[model samples]
Target chain A: GAGVSQTPSNKVTEKGKYVELRCDPISGHTALYWYRQSLGQGPEFLIYFQGTGAADDSGLPNDRFFAVRPEGSVSTLKIQRTERGDSAVYLCASSLGGGRRPYEQYFGPGTRLTVT
Target chain B: GQQVMQIPQYQHVQEGEDFTTYCNSSTTLSNIQWYKQRPGGHPVFLIQLVKSGEVKKQKRLTFQFGEAKKNSSLHITATQTTDVGTYFCAGEGGGTSYGKLTFGQGTILTVHP
Candidate 1:
């Protein structure tokens, strides 16, 4: 792909429902990240993956938000029991590597999730 | 979580006027980056600042990083309608996650031509 790609650009769901968002990073980029941005705010870090392992997930608000990059390529963010506060734009970005190397991040179009 | 603060949350300018936005971080940053997001569009990286008191220019856009490494600024000379967009500053501090960035609440620029 020319750039990072996100699935289901927009999703609408009711409170208490479950929702899943997907991200396909650049073909060979080794680092992936997930961020959430509410209206009138900048993107907030959620999690980052280096290959198959989650290098840092401290940014995730709670256990209700979980993300997985099993094969080290495509990643999925699953929200259990969605709430109205979860409404925001979910952005995905990828970088070259995780350690020592300084890499520039390429972002995706982002998935807008709206919980009613 | 680290927080980045940007002043003048909104700026409106007439065509050919100049505009600027300032960003300040609560902590020292290993590196800082600037991004622009047009209305209804995704953010696009404009440039990165690393060294203290660093300055870079991209056409009519100029960016500066404070010697303290805790602040940054982006200036657009002779603003045009094409320059209308929200500018964001993100900080990457040492010891934080390798690829994590704490973004400032962006500054929205509106140019009337």
Candidate 2:
């Protein structure tokens, strides 16, 4: 089966420009998550979605970051007025949700966003 | 806010040497998952520890969950060059926010063959 997939393996954009990154979760995976990994650092949680609604968005850094998972499958992370600090590898993961035990996450190749 | 801290930001080991990385969480975790990411690659899940004081092994890798469920460790015996990568420990709060994972800083392991 195909694992999670993300679009635009690399994206370079000017600062202050808006950018959107897309993710396609594994088939039948109800839980999807977004994370940002800067060089030499761990992945920072951005948002999580269960079904079509965001289950957790507290990890989002600020109002400039927003994500949507319409139809409970594909998700898009939108960054408005991107800053140099926003440059990082955007990772998307998915797992089988709705169980007492947490399921392991399958990650995508990630989209590296560079704000120039 | 929950945070997962990993120790020894970086480590270097000989091909036949042993390597280990430790992880600690500010809050109690319901489960901890380990992931390995090769250079220039995405993270791949390794294993998950759920029970307190539980230990799981996969070939040369050994994973241990602390009795307090706030810490964990991953050990690799007789390391090989294939072990060169970053290891991450992700903790799940296990409440209403069970799906959201708090990841550790990650430990970069380099193996000299």
Top-lDDT structure, candidate number: 2
Worst 10 residues of 2 chain A by lDDT: A96-105
- Deviating ranges (above 4 Å) for candidate 1: none
Per-residue alpha-carbon lDDT of candidate 2 for residues A31-65, written as tens digits (9 for 90 to 100): 99999999988888899898999988989999999
CA lDDT, every model vs. true structure: 0.92, 0.94
Compute the lDDT of residue B87 as modeled in candidate 2.
99
Error of 2 at B69 (Å): 0.3
* Backbone N/Cα/C clashes per model: 0, 0
**DockQ of candidate 1 relative to the true structure:** 0.72
Residue lDDT tens for model 1, A1-116: 48999999999999999999999999999999999989899989999999999988988999999999999999999999999999999999998886555577888999999999
What TM-score should be assigned to candidate 1?
0.97
Clashing pairs in 1: none
TM-score of 2: 0.97
The DockQ assigned to candidate 2 is 0.76
